[model samples]
Target: MTKSDTITWIRLSAVRLPLPVPVSDAKVLTGRQRPMTEVALLFADIATAEGHRGIGLTYSKRAGGPGQFAHARELAPALLGEDPSDIGRIWTKLVWAGASVGRSGLATQAVAAYDIALWDLKARRAGLPLAKLLGAHRDSVRCYNTSGGFLHAPVGELVENASAAVARGIGGVKIKVGHPDPREDLRRLTAVRERLGDGVPLMVDANQQWDRPTARRMGRALEEFGLVWIEEPLDAYDAAGHAELAAALDTPVATGEMLASVAEHRELMRLGAADVLQPDAPRIGGITPFLQLAALADLDHLQLAPHFAMEIHLHLAAAYPAEPWVEHFDWLEPLFEERLSIEDGRMLVPGRPGLGITLSEQAHAWTTEVFEAGVAP
Candidate 1:
């Protein structure tokens, strides 16, 4: 049999990539202190019998490292001797295999790594970039900066960060809201708007800190600033609350970053929970289900602005029929050798095959543990 016809082996590693500058956000769901020092990245590499290799990765913010890694180990043996190109079948198989303890969270994240690796292999075989392989809708997509606008930073520092991004030609900027005092949130947003001027698009993420009443009140109060959208103003599962908030406010409501599956996104859309969808590729079971979520959002007339990991989202956003926005967060740059190009407020889609990323030597040095899984006899 040809080497490319069957899967040979899978390699997984858990790397502790430290943040250059610790980040803090207002909505502390984990009951932890501000400024998390690092994040755990679970990396997967799949090798074909034909000598082709593809890479995939998923991450956890604080805990769950062992769970995600174990899930990868558990699912790796299922792909032995299977056709790598049969992504749909492989994905379904993995989902059901782990159905007892899967379908969301760590299990789906493990599935994402495998699904993404399959797509990378498929794209490489086709000699086409993933975006083109998926059918390109545009050559580039608009982007906004989110890395610089954290909740713990001083207002002046936030202004400076936004200014730097704007000067670099980023079309928009977003800041964290949901401070304990509503007036503090207002003060920060007002300062940023004044610094950025009226024409530049601005956004705020509450990180699901407020109740429906608070979201309504704050959304109405901030309407005068002319935001691009208000993100995660209520809990992710509070579909009814989100819909009511969207109805009451002029600012478009956006969420779904924390959702683990397309079914959750469907519920959000069916309830009119948001006008914009912010699906994350890894969080939604890789590009396979991400495309599913994107199509659903498009059919429902919702705008697309995928949540972080710009390397993957850039391609996905470029393929969206509507001009979708990609969030910019550079904390993960240390893990990759190559970076995306931004020109005149838009991110250019890479022409490289697959996801167009390579793990850096730094990442290798930072890895804490590694695991290998082989095909079943």
Candidate 2:
């Protein structure tokens, strides 16, 4: 491939991948939603005239798969002959191509698939891992587990899950909080804490279920547990409340995973609302906006613990200036042929070029729809 090489084709696939089991969280306990049994993944594959290829993915939990697929299909034609190496430029072009619906949320989410593909393509073109391409700060990151600690699990299950995670080399454990009965929430926390012991890192997430007074009260109670962080105790958009809570609490406040734009995250930084910023690359328009946000967060001296998509976040987290954390979820494991190595409580960076992942046969078997657009050589 040369500078003259251009994108030849782009393929998009929408797969309705079923979860092995339904998982519930604070949202379910609050009756705002039901257990989630499946996820919708939008995968973008970009190929160039020189036979170079790259893959990227974005996903929706309950809804927006069709919307994202429709939006992605609508924008694929615009990249038929553009240089995939021109990632930032292409990101701007795609954002404007779908400007009517706005740049955040679903529109940018759709663009995220393509944006990430370009980044992956560029890294592969260099024969380097994305982290190395971006100048990595660390070769491994501290890892934690959330899949085993949902609110639906029984106390014994929670302990077992935490034990299993610890035995598997996960450095920290986070469980769902914000139960209908605050006592029950505390009980769960205490049980998990007692089981994990004091030295281990422990965290809890309210999943945006607590109001101001409740958040404050619970934040006060949570102080005794020596939590590494308390996450999303208020609504995702309540920057002011979070700032106030951060000022009042001893535990670090972490949020921003649910936020969908750089502008929204800037508000968090402006107010110093959070101690740890948990940005999801796919959720906020892929690596393009994620990097933009990371740069801003770096300037503020914020801790990075990006939420979900470990395969993608691992590389991005590695590139972060501060020592960052990456989440570990086994749900997406079936979609990729390779597995990440967890050793000594850290997830090691793979030496494979690009994102270092290849889709599994099962991933294709679950695909509900696929489409192609662009000029293939």
Q: Model 1, stretches more than 4 Å misplaced?
A: 1-4, 29-34, 375-377
Instruction: Return the TM-score for candidate 2, rounded to 2 decimals.
Output: 0.98
Give the alpha carbon lDDT tens digit for every residue of 1-377 in model 1. 64448888889989998887778887553344556778888898988877777888888887777788888888888988899888999989998899899698788888888888888888888888889999989989999999998887899899999999999989899999988888988998899999889999999999888888889889999999999999999988999999998888889999999898999999999999999999998987888999888888899989999999898888889889998999988888988999888999999888889888999999999999888877411
lDDT of 2 by residue, 1-377 (tens): 53688898999999988987888988998899889999999999999998899999999998899999999999988999898888899999999999999989999999999999988988998999999999999999999999999988999999999999999998999999989999999999899898889988998999999999999999999999999899999999999999999999999999999999999999999999999999999989999999999999999999999999999999999999999999998899999999999998999999999999999999999999999987654
Q: Pick the candidate with the highest TM-score.
A: 2
Clashes of each: 3, 0
The TM-scores of all predictions, comma-separated, are 0.96, 0.98
Residue pairs with colliding backbones in model 2 are: none
Among these predictions, the greatest lDDT belongs to: 2
